[model samples]
Target chain A: MTSEPLVLGIETSCDETGVGIVRGGTLLADAVASSLDEHARFGGVVPEVASRAHLEAMVPALERASREAGVRLDDVDAVAVTSGPGLAGALLVGVASAKALALGLGKPLFGVNHLAAHVAVDTLEHGPLPQPCIALLVSGGHSSLLLVEDVTQTVTPLGATIDDAAGEAFDKVARLLGLPFPGGPYVDRAARTGDPAYVVFPRGLTSPRDLERHRFDFSFSGLKTAVARWVETREREGQPVPVDDVAAAFQEAVCDVLVRKALDACRTHGVNDLLIGGGVAANSRLRAMAEERCGAAGVRVRVPRPKLCTDNGAMVAALGAQMVARGRTPSGLDLLADSSMPVTVVAR
Target chain B: MLLLAFDTATPAVTVALHDGRSVLATSTIVDAMRHGELLAPGIATVLREAGADRSDLTGIAVGVGPGPFTGLRVGLVTARTLGHVLDIPVHGVCTLDVLAAAAEVDEGQVGSFLVATDARRKEVYWARYSDRRTRVDGPHVSRPAEVATPDVVVGRGATLYPDAFPNAAGPLDPSAADLARLVATGSVPVLEPVPLYLRRPDVAEPTARKSVLTAR
Candidate 1:
């Protein structure tokens, strides 16, 4: 039997510089160096700051990953990297680093898509993916439902956010609530003790009229505006805002809409399995709601652990291992980091 | 000593392969927005032209630019990665110095001249250099109109604002051969491969924390 291919993956698509090593289906190392603290004061990631941080963290992350994996750099069979759908400067850092490794070690290079990697990461945890699974990818930068016939091959776009991404809305609303920079987890925590029915926040794109047209598509900008207006009006009336209630209501609305639409896509496509990935998948509310709703809908739900949901190199390595096992062609040396690379193209 | 050098700080992407004494091969392409796409292929081409395998490279050199943040990071990251993977020392050279050395080589006699390159937003990245091809002062970004006119000016920045620099020579971009030569000659200080972003980043941090409670 052929030994499993050892792949080293690099991901600096955003604020995290991640490096991971995988031997076929088994994960050896997953090391992440986040610049989240640097971006915290800014309330959002500054692209230039993230880029600078990646340059500093990349070498160290690689070293750590190799050491953790107990694999020497020379032993890795191939290199994989996230090529796009991220900050251009950030993506370039990982891409350049991947290229150098591929060139230096004389290994094959795989430039994988960031979004698809999110979906592919589940395979590492849940064994091989059930074909024709509906994947809901929610993060600060993107929110989309993808129909995956094969994580390594075809991923069909079902619907996506027409306005602000789900995580962006969380961050903005969290700011209004005086929460932290990356507001998802904070908002999730704040919502725990509050009443979800205190105020009925609008569930975006769920109106009967919207369902007829944009049933799968999402729009959160209006919901964000509504939250802001509600807060401002309470301030104008000199009423003390019930921050906990507001957090709970907002989280309920967002999760309700997300889970509703994701299950709808699964039903429409006749897919029995649903997978949720990306940073927003780390939200406790989203996970619980998705599991409950999908359970009732007779759709099996698959979500990697929270650590795997966020941006990491292990996902890229998993996808790369899949590509190699399936005999997919490796990317040429001239591969470019495409910031707006669509989710359909898994590799470039 | 087999060396591989590249620069993507300017609009052009340059790559070169060199021995200690002479450049074995070099290629430069003026591609404004495609540095990420062009650079790896350019390196492969140069290495092939020089009849050297990628594994044969003993060291890597790259331009640590005072250029646009996006383009400049590509070369630096690439150099650093190569160095880390190959276990070789990566040398970082000021891109402006490469242009100055090129100018000196081209003109044979170089007095005090300014090396300027496009910094976008109508500003130029300018540095003063002496006749010995040494960087005298300023890897600064300034409005072309505010820059002190020099006896001779080199680079795309001088050509762009002709009225500001009337004595400006024709266009010049940093070359890969010069980047390789800088490492070969040991004329310039080889600093840690950190980006020379002379200006503060555009994004600002939040000034004051928002109040969670209303004063009322």
Candidate 2:
């Protein structure tokens, strides 16, 4: 309602029903209601369950966001929603709610890409992003390398996982170690006191042959299989598989490859800043390694706080705020919730 | 009372505007896969036709389906949000009841009949009614052959199972206009703004897998 765009963002790309309100570059409120407990019993996210939870959580989250921001819904200047690269049904719930809010309030709607939102969230913490930065986005469903010329306008796809995502690999390895579902945080916790040199795990896609074809691409499925084989051999030989040591070793491999490639991309693109964003960005080792590696290489690593790193509405709002500031055209009410929406189309 | 109603329980994305007295305008676009894309635009068109805006709405009504989960959630999510923004009352009407209401008025032919809609997986979502106003049994999901054969049947399931529903009649789908009428008249039971999914989400607890740790 004011001169600065007051944006409301809805994110149902996965198990979280997140609603965030942002006034210009400053974040106002971030209200998130996660259905992670529901999916935890299933070992992973179920699309139908997630969709239903989003519907149940949508209205409440919206109210909470506006209340926290101390602003009425009518005060919002525009609405933003994560419209892609997620579960089909889950994305639809958010896209539908956002459309309705935009329609009801007579405001513009911005259907944004989930990946681009992750990259743009960084700008909220660290003032405007330096153009032409390399971003390594890692999460449960995706492990993509992106070149960001602008968050609102242009983003070039560099590479992605050839098989399993880094978070998914962490989950699978955690299960093998008898840890809980969504073991990214738990693995990070257990690996702290354990020895990283306990076992030598293969770093995926780092070999010269692999680099020739997939210089920026990642592969964790083979490493996951290698970890499984090693544990099985240890158990079969009547030796107890040390859970902590295995966690540390596995975590080290994933972090090493991620930091190594990210710094390499920064060097290759002649970009001075390296940004890490997504669920995996919250990992202690990934953060430390990126900071350490980028510090050595002189390409500053920018990662938003852990809350913004994982999926949430603030990220989407951050991207939407950029779109409004840049005077980008709003998407029509017929904005499609494309499950595979590419990062190239930042705001659809 | 300006009431806006919609249903995405089936492939048809329907919207209607009611100005407390009669139906002002209504639209239905039957596209199976475009529920998310078509719903807001459909509502926008109906509002434009009625020469009104979404802020002019006083109440919201939506079909909480014993229908598909994905499409059904679209309507509920939209309806709830619109209600929230407008600070209006949202009435959740049973989708089958809306079809039954339409059958009683338009066709005026019914007594102890069944209303069934397509429930996918080769099944139908059906409920029996003593008349248009009172449901007698069902709102259950089953194969067509498993449903009680009534002399009269209404809704899309009738078109889907011709042999079983020989007397398939009334409306093929529930429109937003009829849903609006039901909510306005208080003719049917108002439900919580949640899905009426008769089936649970298809998932199971992870069975004990033969883990490598157990290899010893």
Candidate 3:
């Protein structure tokens, strides 16, 4: 039997330095070293702090990934790394480390997109993505919709959030409620025990009259402020605030808008397959709502395991493997890290 | 004993080839914030001029800084990767130690000295060396005036903030020869070199929160 190609993936776009090894879409190992605890005190990422954390975690994460994959470093056939759309300092650590590995091993190098990797990871779990699908990438840093025609070739932007992203809204609202740093999970948990209709928070960019104007676009800054103002008014009036009730109401507003927009795009574009990826996709309420709404609309929804829902190396490597399988060209040694690398094109 | 040393701590890419006997060739390109564009090409030119290549390297040395985040990553990453590729061990010498090694101090009198480098954002990256010329405390970003020190201060960092370091070094006196010599001694620690980004990025996306003054 011919040995399958061993593709190693490295990701350091954010607080986590993740490394994973895969063989023909089969996940062998997935290791991540997170600096979430370090940033928890600040309630948001400090770029400098995140960069230093990447430098420290790079070597150790790679070692753990190789060990778990049960393969020596030399056994790796190709290397894939996330090259953009992140903190420049943080991105450099992963890119530079990857280049060195690729140069040393004399292996082919593939620079994968962090956002595309989020979409590509689904193939690892669900076999293959149906072509002509829409990808709703909602993370702390990004909230955009894309029309993905292929895993390796085409990803055209459908729409994106105009102001604060969906995840950022969760974080901001959570802070207003005096919750933890990562508001997504905290609010999701708190909402389960509370009532969704208690506050009647606004759903941004959603109006029957304005439906034709921004059918696919999203806006969360208004939602975030609305939550803040509601909390402030309760405190000012000395009306005892119900944290759970507020959390539930805020989460419902976000989910309601997200599902409604996604379904609208699906119906308009006639693309029935909807895929959601990123950190906020890990929210239980969002997952349940997506399932319920997609079912009612008779549209299919594919979401990776919760672990793959957030940033990870497996997604980057999976994207790389798919590119290699399709004979996509690799990036030049001089490829610069575009901190704002768009979610379109491969090996630029 | 062949040693390859380079620093991207500043806008300049300084490359040196030392055969343990003498310095063969030292080349520098002053492109300051263009390290991502000039570093590799500068490396190629330096090695070509020295009549050597990656295979001829025995040990690699790098200035593990207290420098700008993006620029410092290039040098450290290149040095570490090169060390791994050549199967030669790598050594990380402090940027201040390299500067101190080049100081024109009195031959027998190792007086108290301060080494400061521009830490950007109206601050200096500083470390103090005593009579033994041992580092006291730093690789941190602080006002030069605030970096409690004994006497004469040195390094380009002090030069950038003149008022901060009243007694500072003359110019970019930091040489790769000094870095090469330190690596040969094997005295510096092998800890992974981290870019000393002491603070967060200055710019953040605008938050939609009402101004605190408005709330008040």
TM-score of chain B of each: 0.90, 0.92, 0.83
Candidate 2, lDDT over the whole model: 0.90
Clashes of 3: 3
Clashing pairs in 2: none
Model 1 per-residue lDDT tens digits across residues A1-348: 979999999998999999989999888999999999988888999998999999899889999999999989999999999998899989998998898889888899999999999988888898888988999999999999999998887988888999999999999999988888899999999999989999899999998999998989999998888888788789778998888899999999999999999999998999999999999999998989998889998999999999999999999999999999999999998888889999889999
Q: Candidate 3's residue-wise lDDT over B64-181, tens digit each?
A: 7777778787778767765654677777767777776676556265367777777777787777767324677766788766874445677787667667666665446456666776
* Predicted candidate 2, C-alpha RMSD: 2.0
**Stretch of 10 with least lDDT, candidate 3 chain B:** B206-215
Q: What is the interface RMSD of candidate 2, in Å?
A: 1.9
Instruction: Order candidates by lDDT, high to low.
Output: 2, 1, 3
Tell me which of candidates 2 and 3 scores higher on DockQ. 2
The numbered model that scores best in DockQ is: 2
Per-residue lDDT of A297-320 in model 2, one digit per residue for the tens? 899989999999999999999899
For residue A137, what is the lDDT in candidate 2? 97
Predicted complex 1: CAPRI docking category: medium
Q: Is candidate 1 or candidate 3 better by TM-score?
A: 1
Per-residue lDDT, model 3, residue B62, is: 77
Q: lDDT at A348 for candidate 3?
A: 54
DockQ of each: 0.54, 0.71, 0.29
- Local distance difference test scores for all models: 0.89, 0.90, 0.79
Which has the better lDDT: candidate 2, or candidate 3?
A: 2
